[model samples]
Target: MTETTIRKPIRKAVFPVAGLGTRFLPATKAIPKEMLPIIDRPLIQYAVDEAREAGIEQLIFVTGRGKTAIVEHFDTAFELEATMSSRGKDLSILAPTRIQPGNLVTVRQQVPMGLGHAIWCARAIVGNEPFAIFLPDELMIGSPGCMKQMVEAYNEVGGNLISVLEVPEEEVSSYGVIKPGAKVSGSLTEVVGLVEKPKREEAPSNLIISGRYILQPEVMRTLEGQEKGAGGEIQLTDAMAKMIGNQAFHAVTFAGRRYDCGSKSGFVEATLELALERSDMAADVRAAIKRLAATFD
Candidate 1:
């Protein structure tokens, strides 16, 4: 039998930024959660940057109320650009961050449904193309972005790819766990099953699902009639599970540091660790850490 070639290119990426960041509280009251700064750049910027690095041409944002700021952030601000240019400052730094004209699109999700619903909001834009979905809250840092790694895996396997990371058994319940199948290659596994937030004892594997996803267009049809799963929300994983028999599903164990920016403590840890890696901040952070440790002693 001849092998079938995957025709669609993963050009478009969907970002579900409509959530009311209740966890962040008062800070998120006016500011959209995606705008919350991880270090100097907003959380959404990192996700967008990751997508662009992964060769995504169109950035589709599924937004809601108070999310206009996110749209504006990616757009060029004439006043700011002019001011910086006049001051002889490096303007190129802002250029890559700005989404190229006509490449960025925003669709509003009126109701706070769920991840699945947010993804479905972009159905019109995604059309029949195999696209990517990124969660800004899952901050992945590496030489090549997590999605790019998954894209490479997709090219090899020619199927739907989800980024998975091996977590301790105790932490498996905190994330969606994937059941292992045949080992396809190094860091790539054929996914037989997926369990969302399963208890440690019931977890099929230690490989917990992270944010990066390269999905087939057919999954949208599954979401169209899919009911809510897990926390009474329309979970994307539920729809993905439906595609098991019909589609080729693979889990790519991403080689990167994933920080769950959705949680307060995780965000702080990411900030500190990322900051420590910077040449400018390394010495200062190290000195401060040493001082703090000495105080505890």
Candidate 2:
């Protein structure tokens, strides 16, 4: 098995947590949707965890007005920690929430722009180096985590790479589908083209671009003068499409389950599925699920 050559170590990662998260309202009315927990940890935490696992050093959060909670989640809760310490309760539980000093960075996206604009907001912080992007709403579940797998692949290939997963043909219209070039390996495919939310028949393939991406800094230049393509928003897909031929773009077919927590159904499914996987909660969650199903019957 080949190992990561570390051509350029991925140091920074951007988390676009600026969206209003209207789908999960009024719950999200007061709280950021990224703060909504899957079981114990918030969605953004999972993304950060993945980044940390992948050896990312800097965590950049592109945030909005109401998203302060997202940043606070990673900070040290002194009062809570003191209370826990005084009570002699297990303090290690807070370990996952704690980020190392000077590692966490925040940049604001004042308007509710598209994902591309949110990402571009962090370009100054990202400098000239390559960075990873993580959409917190997409709860990717895997043993090594999604970003770790992508980092390993990125270390090997050292170009642009987006995590792709084959969704159903009927669902192709809902996602940015990739026009595949060649199957480089079982899990790697050269991305010749990208069609954002293409009609099912017009879709190049069933593979949809998932939430994770490792992009070159040149993309920032492409997005600098980029006009809105779809929905009058600066779409990342449009910028990435322009970089296809100029750069080596590929897709890493995700070998994990992705829970689209952006939608109501997906949120509930993620909560229940993750809960059931927990040893402490599984039995009770299973019984509760059976009881809930009985009401419908």
TM, every model: 0.96, 0.97
Question: Model 2: per-residue lDDT, tens digit, 1-297?
Answer: 333444667999999999998988899998999999888888888898899999999999999988889888889999999999999899998898898899999999998769899989999999999999999888899978888888888877888999999989999999999999965787889999999888988999999988999999999999898998778899899999999989889899988999999999999999999898899989999999899899998
Give me the overall lDDT of model 2: 0.90
Off by over 4 Å in 2: 1-6
User: lDDT tens digits, residues 19-90, model 1?
Assistant: 999999999999998898877889999999999999999999999988999999888899999999899998
Cα-lDDT of candidate 1: 0.90
Q: What are the RMSD figures for all models against the true structure?
A: 1.5, 2.1
* lDDT for residue 47 in candidate 1, whole number 0-100: 93
Worst 10-residue lDDT window for candidate 2 reads: 1-10
Ten consecutive residues with minimal summed lDDT in candidate 1?
A: 1-10
